[model samples]
Structure formats: C-alpha cells, structure tokens
Target: MTSISASEGCEKGLAPGHFAPETAYLDTASAGLPPAEAVTAITSALTAASRGTATVGGYFEAAADARARFARLVGVAPGRVAISASAAVHTGLIAQSLPAGSEVLVADGDFASLVNPFHVRPDLRVRTVPLERLADGVRPGTALVAVSAVQSADGRLADLDRIAAAARAHGARTLVDASQSAGWLPLDAGAYDFTLVVGYKWLLAPKGTSFLVVPEDLGGLTPVFAGWVAGEDPWGSCYGQVTRLADCARRFDETPAFFSYVGARHSLALVEELGVERIGRHDVALADRFRAGLADLGRTPVPAPGSAIVAVPGLGTAAGRLAAAGVRVSSRAGGLRAAFHLYNTAADVDRLLEVIAGT
Candidate 1:
C-alpha cells in the first residue's frame, strides 16, 4: 500500500552485503544465512581452538551466553533453557519421558521432527489430528499435544493460544516446535510446557545449535536417557561417584559444540538488537507483496495470515524455474514455498514474481 518499497527495510537491520547479489535465496524455512557478525564470531572461536588459546572457562561462558540469549528470545529464564544439537533430539527426550500409555495429540502433516519422536514410543498412543482442529481435539485421554507454531510446508500459523488453553483445561502438556517461527515472530515460552527451536532455520546460526525450553515446574520430567555431561559434575558422575545433576533444564544439555554456541550467541544478540517486532514487520511486508504479485498473475497463494512463508501452486516447477534463473526457493504442499527473512528485499520478491510470470 505504501510507495516506499521492500529493500529499504534491510537498511535498518544488517545490510545484505553478506549474500551474493546474483541469487535471491527464499528458503529460510530450510536454513537461515548467518549474519556477518555470527560468522566472524565462529571464525574467531575456531581460530582460538586451533591455536590452543581456547579455555574450558571460555567454552562454558559462551554456552551460557547462548543459553541466556535463547531464553530471552523465547521469553523465559535462562534456567529454563537447554542447549541441544537439534530439535529432534529434544523432541525424542520429551516424548520418551511421558508416562507409559500416555496419549499424545499431534497435527497431521507437521514436520517429522515433531511427530516422529512419538511414533517410536510404543508406550505412548499418538493421534494425528487436523491442524485447525487441534484445539477441539483435546480430550480427557490426551496427555500431551505437540504442534508446530507455523506449518513449515504451507506457512499456516497455528492458533497456539487456543491450543495451549485447551491443553491446559484437559490436563495435557503442550509442546510447540518453533523451528520456523521462533526467530521470525514473537513467542512466549510460558504459554507452553515445552518449546523446541532449531537454530539453523530462523535463528541465523549454525546447524549444530538448538534450544529447548522447560519451565521450572516441568523439571520433574527429566531426561529419559542422559549423557555424562548431563550431570552437575561430568567427571565426578562418570567416576562412579553419585552426584546430583543440575536441577534446571541444563540436565538435558549434553556435551555441546562450543563453537556453534559462539556463533548462535552472536546471532541471537544481533536479532535482539534489530528487534524481533521490526524483523517480523520486514518479513511480512515482503511476503505480502510477493503474494499480491502472485495474485496479479492469476495465481492464488495459500493463505498464511501474518506469516512469512508464501505458497502458490505449481511450486515444484516454479522452484525449478526460479533456481535455474538463480532465484532459490522451495517446493512444499503442492506450491512454491518462498520464505522472506531479514535478508530479503523487494527486489528479490520482484525477481520471483518475474520468474513465475515468465514461466
């Protein structure tokens, strides 16, 4: 609606100088491009490690910093956050901790990271429900409800508030996979018993870094299988000495990749500086324009209100054409899944539109 276009938003955040000019990558749902600051921090940490300048104390400090930043990003105390290698690991841990014969409700077609964990748990009964009916599906038998904050394939934003409220009323714990939404939208960890995030997707961090939020009261659901690092004193616990593990969420944090934490810390800090609200605005603006352009081409995109991912029909062919033209995109839900992020611009949207129109 405004004459002032898209690329202008990039100026207020990190400049897009880090990305190659020839390509317009719109697949943040798969992985995010780390900011220059994050890359620099990772490089420095690697150099220090190679030179034998990195100390155990430094590693702990960086990990703590990343934990605190991720906690802030999700509106939780640092003690409530646990670092993990991937969302799937934390998902499996939570799924395994549920009592035997517990009933779990999950939305059908959610990314495998959210549902696969429950599948392997023969003791738990997993029900696949419609995404829109998740709230209505909460029944007396449902012990847990797992959902993605935003559907990765079609960008359908889940009504997490309604689902969480319903789960609470039904005495069910709520777990939300925020892999595609955490860094792009506002999230309240207090709203759910557990929140899983993958750093490589929307957090602009390396693949090895991920976060899981477990409120203090939920600490009773301890890790089903813990590594030596999960104890308070890794060395002492390993040497046949019984020791207390951390009372907080750190009990689930095994030996983490410290270098990935360094990069994630820097990236999270940059996101905080830029402001998540502003980033959401920038992303939605570009996505809205892209959707509008699709409409102009007689193509109706899948509805994803207030979401950054836009989907349109013939996605596979369109993605192929776009990639051949040096414009990167993804195909999902029988449509082209173009995800706009802090790094994208109006020019990128225009290029995608042009390619689609030409095809």
Candidate 2:
C-alpha cells in the first residue's frame, strides 16, 4: 500500500486532503471508499435510532429531503424522485406501468441484478442486444428497452441519446440503468433525450439506493405504491385517506432507509459542492493519463472512452496472474478488464501498468 490523496474545497467549509493507499485503491471500480461525511451521517442516524428518535415522522421528512437532493443531482423534480431500495425494484415498478406483453431490450452482459427481474416475469419478453447488434431490430410490441448507461463488464458507455430517440420513434419507453455512470457522467434528466434512467453505481452512493427520473407529462404511468409513508400522503394526510400512488417518479415503492438516505444525501451534497462536472473532469483527466502511460505495452482503450471506467487490453494470460496478487480487478465477458472512480490516482495506474509490464 502507498499513501496518496485528493480533496475538494467549498465555501463556508474546507475539506482536508484525503489519504488512502494508492496501490490499493484502483480497485474501487469494484467498491469505493465511503466519504468521512457519509460515515458521520450514518453514525448520527444510528445514534438517533438508539435514542428513540428514529421516528416514522422523521423518516418521511428525511425521505423527502433525500428526494430533493437526489432529484437535483439527477436533474428531476422531487415528486419525480422515487426512492427505490434497488434499481431493479425501480424497473419492476416501470414494468407494471406498461402493458403485460411488452418486449424490452438491453446489453446481454450487464450486472445481473439489473436483468433478473425481466427474466423472471413471464408476461414480459426480454431480449439481449449485444453491443455489436444493438441496432438489429425492435418489434412493434416492444414496450421498454432497459439498458445500463455504462455496462459493468467492459465499461462501454451506452449512447443514451441514440437509444432514447429510437425508443421515442418506436413508441417504447426507455429505462436506462444509470447505475455505473451516475457520479462519473454529467446526466441531467432534463437534458436526457431518454425519459427514464436510474443511477446506482459510480455514484458512490450505497448499494440498494437509486433514483428514477421519468418524463414530466406522461399521463399516469403506473403507481409504485410501495411506501407506507407514501400511502399516508406526505402533504398531510393519513395512509388510508390516500389510495392513489404518487404522480411523479415517487410512484415506485421506497423503503425509508433513513441512514442510507442520509449517507447518500451527504455524498450528493459533497458532489454538488465540489461540482459534478468538476468531479467528472478530474476523473477523465486521470483516466487519460493512465491510458497514455500504458503506451509502452501497445494497449488499446475500451470501446467507448467513459469517465468512471477505463481499460488496458492485450494482457492475455497475464491478466489471471495479476488477479492472484490481490489487485482486485474482475474480468468482463470480453477480453477487456477495467478500473474506475475518484479513489484511484496516477500511482495506482502506474502500479497496474507495472504489474502488466513485469508479467
């Protein structure tokens, strides 16, 4: 392990420079380091819970606040924000909103959690569109095309604009699993040609936490209807009084993981303070530096030059040996493997390159 760090400066407060193992952290494309603030948020919530202050009342209020933070980050309305325990849960709600016979399309090899729901549902038909064959065909009955913005395996950035426009032309709804691209990309829901996309990964937010942004004027998609507090109508009514689901993205059921919400909110707050585009700019610059450093090895970049993830191909048999050393990069289906996120530094990249070169 080696010592190195990065930091952000904000008004009214100045965060100290971070220090973590440079040799150890390139693997964070696997799981990132939790922010100091997020850790504090969780501790504070647990403290409140221990003190009998984790009330149902406070939970809803915090949920609404979380909704606003997340909505602003993703460029959507608080009402459009549906607090889902997982991106798949958000997709399940979208599935229910559309017709039963809907056909959906997506990358064949995405993180499994995103694909399992459609496969399990008998009424819905799902198709795997290999990156090469993405333009193949969409039948008339195709209702939704579920895709990951940046596929987990090779880290290819999905062309959201193209896919969104295609779905619009075909009259099919688009469900982009923005899981891995959230913290890495500049995703404005308002700017999104695609109406619905949920952020999960790369955001450094907790697992099982995601935000879904649906279009503004679609007439009553479907009611997610899974929140107990939501049933009570957060505006001021009791549960039974409000039988209707939320009109915006909140239509999906959301469990009040107040602690996780606080953690995520803190992360978003940091992202906002530091600036999303700024964070992304830094990430891309780091990746380009890493890629350039690999020139001696005749390596090539991944399919798309995405921010959160980057690859150095041509490792061949050397790749397996590198993993045994506890370097922590998992393989994608294709020959390419990748590294990601802000926890990484130039030193980490050099070490990975050193491993490959030494091999």
Candidate 3:
C-alpha cells in the first residue's frame, strides 16, 4: 500500500489551481472537474464552431487522438478501440450480439447501464450474483460475464483476473465496465474480451465521450449502431449505404461528439502525462486518510482496502451538510461516498472528516 504525498501528487500534475479554490471536490466517481487545458480546448472548439471556422476533419482528428490515447492508457492497440457515446451503447451492442437464450452473468447491484441492457433483452437469461461471487458464477452455459471493474454504489473492486480466467475456462467472454476505475486504477483492458470506459468521470473529460475496447477479432459483436463514422472512408460513406466498413474496431464507432472529443483529447493527454500508477497511489492515500479519520470518529466505512472510494454507512444524511460546507461528495446506496483522485489533498480528507464528526 504505497502512497504519494499530496505535494508529490501535485508535482506529478495535480493542478489545484485548475479547480475552484473554496471547494473540496471528492466526487470524481460522479463526474470529474475538467482540467484547465481541457476547458480551454472545449472553449476553443466552441469559438471556432461559432465563427464557422470549425472543420469536420479537425473534429475527426481530435477523436482519433483521443481514441489512441485511451488505447494506450488501457494497454491496447488503437485499432482495437472504438469511440462510443456511453458504456450502455457498447453494452447494448454486446447484448445484441448474444444468441437468443444465452446466459449472461452479472454482478447484483452493478451500475444500471451495465446490467439493464442485458435484462432488456428478454431472450437472454440474465443471472445476478454478488460481486465477490461473480467469478464463481461463470458456468458452462454462460455466454458472457459482465461486471464493473469497480462498483459504483460501494468501492468494491471485482476480481477481474479471476473472473476473466473463469470466463475463459467456461468458454464465455468477459465484458468489463471500467467507468469507475480507468483513471485512478491500472487496467489491462486487453485481458477482457470487452472493456468499456466513459471519459467524463475519472478521465476528466466532457460528457458524451466514451471508449470501448474489443478483441482483435471484434469479439463477435456486430456494428449494429454504426453510421457514417463506422465507414472505411467516413466522409465518402455519408450519403448512401456503406460500401465497406472499417476493418478494425472502428467499424463499431459511434458518430463522434466533436466538442467532447475536442476536450477529451487534451484531458487524456494530462492523464498520460501524469500516469495512472501515480494517480492511483495519490488517490488511495487520500481515501485511506479519510478511512483512518472515520475510524477515530467511531464511524465504519464499507471495507475497501487499497481503493480510492470510501463509502460510510449512516452518513448519507450528512451529504447536504457536507455540500453546504463546500465539500462535494455523493450519497448512494444509503451511504456517503467520497472518491479521491490525484487532485484531492490531505486537507480535503481532514475537512470531510471534520464535517462528518460535527454531523
């Protein structure tokens, strides 16, 4: 359980000046504050659009840059990554690819976007198991084992290596929703058959930007949602039927949200510059500091060792008070959930503890 001191984290690129001076934001799991660079990029894009100087090619290039950065972050080739609007969009595509009556194993109480898509398809058999038991739930009949790498309600991390191995042993594919883990956790997206990440949260990008990584063979998923962006020559295929789709995972691409991608490109650059391992150590240090403070206050948080999210039971009711005190956090599953990122500090952890102690 190594950690980076707040000062060390700042040196590594946690620019506190980019955030509001008065607020202690501990809710990255909900949405991250975009860095100054990302904000500038977004504003520039908007200005260019308003001036009628924005080109479609520029937007496409921005998206391509973002896609490659994300692939690098997750240890995959850019050709294996598909630009997406949301994790649900990719989840639905995976669901559509499943044969009728295929068994889909999912973690109970996982994020709705990851679980609902499978449930919506009545033809599929969806089974729910506890996150801890998800690996054991994989069976001979399981077509896919879908779970979040990090639980949103609580900070429970799935045993991804074990689950992936079990799925492989059972002849099933694995789909991992990394929305909660990507920026602050080191993830090898290539280990799973499908890995989906939404950039608005930990990646510190704008909404409407996400990424999906699939196996080299495309993991048997059909590009049912593909539009002009999925074409081998996107501009050329804009009007009529696509004469040829992309040979790689780009064939599954959703039309890029230009403004979001424009911002995402710069945001992901910051992440790469700082490195995920450094961010994770900084984040976990802050979370551990908070956990220790809560223990001294006679409050117990859900046990999550080495995690960047701390969920304290019975403190959900204190969220409004904390928010009023300028400490931003989230209330979920009847608890107060505070997520730490590279930007968080020891002072932020102390402020949260002081408010909770008062409440």
Tens-place lDDT per residue, model 3, 170-246, is: 99999999999999899999899999999999999999999999999988888899898899998889998998999
lDDT to native, each model: 0.84, 0.62, 0.90
TM-score of 2: 0.82
Best by lDDT: 3
lDDT of 1: 0.84
lDDT score at residue 219, model 3, on the 0-100 scale: 85
Q: Considering TM-score, where higher is better, how would the candidates rank from best to worst?
A: 3, 1, 2
lDDT of 1 by residue, 147-177 (tens): 9999999899999999999998998989999
Preferred candidate (lDDT higher): 2 or 3: 3
Q: Against the true structure, what is each candidate's TM-score?
A: 0.93, 0.82, 0.97
Q: Once superposed on the true structure, which residue ranges of model 3 sit more than 4 Å away at CA?
A: 1-7, 10-13
Per-residue lDDT tens digits of candidate 2, residues 143-166? 777777777666678777777777
Every candidate's CA RMSD: 2.8, 5.2, 2.0
Model 3 scores a TM of 0.97
Error of 2 at 72 (Å): 1.5
